[model samples]
Target: AQSVTQPDARVTVSEGASLQLRCKYSYSGTPYLFWYVQYPRQGLQLLLKYYSGDPVVQGVNGFEAEFSKSNSSFHLRKASVHWSDSAVYFCVLSGNNYAQGLTFGLGTRVSVFP
Candidate 1:
């Protein structure tokens, strides 16, 4: 079984500051990892995903994530954040079985202060 863990339940950062959200996964084999963001009263949007190839992948709105197989972690990072970036971010893990569905972390709520 695959599972994800986001140690931080809440994160706060000043506008224009860099940010990193930690994510850890537990899976026996290579698993699909994804970061999704949910805005206030809106559906979740895909921030980035990693399955193979390069460890680093660029996402929308200056977001990016690095996958580390050795550490069993996929952490999301942003060079600089804006106040509008405030939202809830979820770390998800998916195995080969689609029917089993994806396992999601509790989520990290980010608050960007001006």
Candidate 2:
């Protein structure tokens, strides 16, 4: 079984400041890590994914995440955030070939202040 834990329920960042969101996962085989952003009343958009190559994966809107197999963590980071970046971030793990279900974290609501 695959699972994810997002420690923070919410994060507030100032406009033009950097941000990092924490995520941890538990899986047996190779885990497919992903970061998804969801705006109010909108569906989740794929930020990035880590399957085979590179430990550091880049995503849209200057967002990036580092996959650490040792720590079992994949934390999202942004050099500078904008007010428009305010939204809910979710860490997800895709189940292996059988079900391929997505296990999502509770969520972290990011409030960007200007």
Candidate 3:
């Protein structure tokens, strides 16, 4: 089975500042990884995903994520953040195939101060 863990529960940063959210996943075999974000009163949206090939994948709204097998991590990063970026980010792990069930982390709440 695959599992995800987001170390930080909440992160506060000033608007326009660079931000990075940590995500750790545990899975023995190859797994499908994804980063999802949820805004206030909205459903979760896919940010980026890593399946094979490239270790880095670009996402919407200038967001990107890097997958590391050795470290068992898939961290999300944004060079500059906006107040609109404030939301709850989740690290999701689907098993070896996408059809399998998905396991999500507790999620990290990001707040951007203006």
Candidate 4:
């Protein structure tokens, strides 16, 4: 089975500060990776996703993620954060097809301070 782990349960960053969220995934075969952010009262928004092409993919709102096959990691980064960026980020993993459904990490809560 595929699994994702988000080490940090919560992260606090100041406005305009660079942010990085760690995500480690375990899968027997090539997998699809995604990062979703959920605001206080909104649905999950797709931040970025990786399937096969580039190692690094750009996401919305200055967010980007890099997939490392050797390291089994897909880490998310932002050059600068804003107060409105505060939300819960989820690391999602899926098999080649969606037969097994998606595996999600516990989710990391981000708090951006002004």
| Candidate 2: residue 7 Cα off by (Å) | 0.3
lDDT accuracy of residue 20 in candidate 3: 96
List ranges where model 3 is wrong by over 4 Å.
97-100
lDDT of every predicted structure (CA atoms): 0.96, 0.93, 0.94, 0.96
RMSD of each: 0.6, 1.0, 1.3, 0.9
Whose lDDT is higher: candidate 1's or candidate 2's? 1
**How big is the RMSD of model 2?**
1.0
TM-score of 1: 0.98
Model 1, clash count?
Answer: 0
| Residue range 37-84, candidate 3, lDDT tens digits | 999999999998899998999999999999999999999999999999
- Candidate 3 yields a Cα-based lDDT of 0.94
Ranking by lDDT: 1, 4, 3, 2
lDDT of 4 by residue, 45-74 (tens): 999999998899999999999999999999
- The candidate that achieves the highest TM-score relative to the unseen native structure: 1
Report the lDDT of model 4 for residue 62: 91
**What is the total number of backbone clashes in candidate 4?**
0
Any runs in candidate 4 off by more than 4 Å, and if so which? none
By descending TM-score, how would the candidates be arranged? 1, 4, 2, 3
Task: Name the lDDT value of residue 50 in candidate 3.
Answer: 90
Candidates 1 and 3 compared by TM-score, better number: 1
TM-score, cand. 2 vs. native: 0.96
